[model samples]
Target: MLCSDLVAHYGLKKSRRVSIQESLGIFLLYLAYGCGNRLVQEFFNHYGEIIHRHFHKVLDVVVNLSKDIIKPNANFNETIPEHILNNPRYYPYFKDCIGAIDRTHVKAYVPQRYQIKYIGRKNYVTQNIMVACDFNMCFTFAWAGWEGSAHDTKIFNEARRRREVKCPLPADGKFYLVDAEYPNKKGYLAPYRGSNIRYHIPDFRRGQTRAVREPKGFKK
Candidate 1:
């Protein structure tokens, strides 16, 4: 039941080499166990003859199919839920916030020569992945393939270079929420620095609390 729904949602079709169900099954198994080829084959109670090769083949097919549709290269826009729109308690920034951005590394074993360049300073051989998530926490953008040594700020700059987010920052001051690894650049906001603590509100308040907090230099 769920498999059919997923296939329809993902718009996957029967490949020339395999059935849609089989491909879906391989993907599910990968997500379930995060196992290597041999381990995945063992989990499926099969030898290397069939399922192992098919798993990778299915992955390649799906990745190619999904490449264009996965990430939308548009600037952030407000698509606030009906309930949240009417609630004064919620921060108005929720509507203006384009997305939350972060980077992570996926560990892998590669050749020594490759690992020399790929392994990060922390000594973990990893592939760096950066992603941007909308207000709903769904990924709207992702970039993978950089080495783990790549910094999150560098990844963001590169993402900008790709011309994906071409829209200008909002005139009324829209911004992005990013981690400490990112700089407090224009069009993006990070936590207030210790040196600049006097300028920012320690905690944003709502409703009557806003009135009490407003006079103390927390006004938006």
Candidate 2:
């Protein structure tokens, strides 16, 4: 059904030699099987070299369509959902929290000269992607395509400036959770420098069998 909808929307008419359905099938198979172009050619033997050309065209159509399909639901005025407000672990402190923000590195390929810009401390080429997700595990914002060597704070500042992924300032005493990598500014809350709980979790797990003790005066 989705494939048919894409065909209609993109006006991907069937060619004299190969039908639209078959062309789409070749593209999906390459993705689903994680196979190379040669392997895909082997699978669709009848289409032969034609699959190679059609593959990129269909891929381009899908990439263009994804801009609308894969964006955050930017509803700033919406109140905290009832489900999050009722949860014991999140009720009081995080009741005002809208979401969590973090960055991760994803492997990427680039030209030799440009590869140096994408290389991070991990000694690999990657794209540093910033993602914001709510308690419901749904993404509220994403800022991607930054160089892997870029700092998280720098990326966050740029995203805010460009309004590319507009993270609305929290109103009515609400806020968003972020790690120490970000500044403890107006709408964003970060953990304390020396007493961050994440730092203690690994050490706590190494020696403990029973309930782990909280770090001195660590607040929930």
Best by TM-score: 2
- Show pairs that collide, candidate 1: none
Q: Cα lDDT of all candidates, in order? A: 0.63, 0.74
Model 1 CA lDDT for position 65: 47
Q: How accurate is candidate 2 locally (lDDT)?
A: 0.74
lDDT score, candidate 1, position 104? 81
lDDT of 1 by residue, 106-193 (tens): 8866778888767886688998887776655667666777888887778878787776433233334566777667767777887654
Candidate 2 segments whose C-alpha is farther than 4 A from its true place:
7-23, 45-67, 71-77, 164-172, 195-197, 200-204, 207-220
Candidate 2 residue pairs in clash (backbone atoms < 3 Å): none
> Taking the tens digit of each residue's C-alpha lDDT, what string does model 2 give over 57-163?
78877755654555545564367755577888767766778877888899987889999989987799999998887767877666668999998889888877875
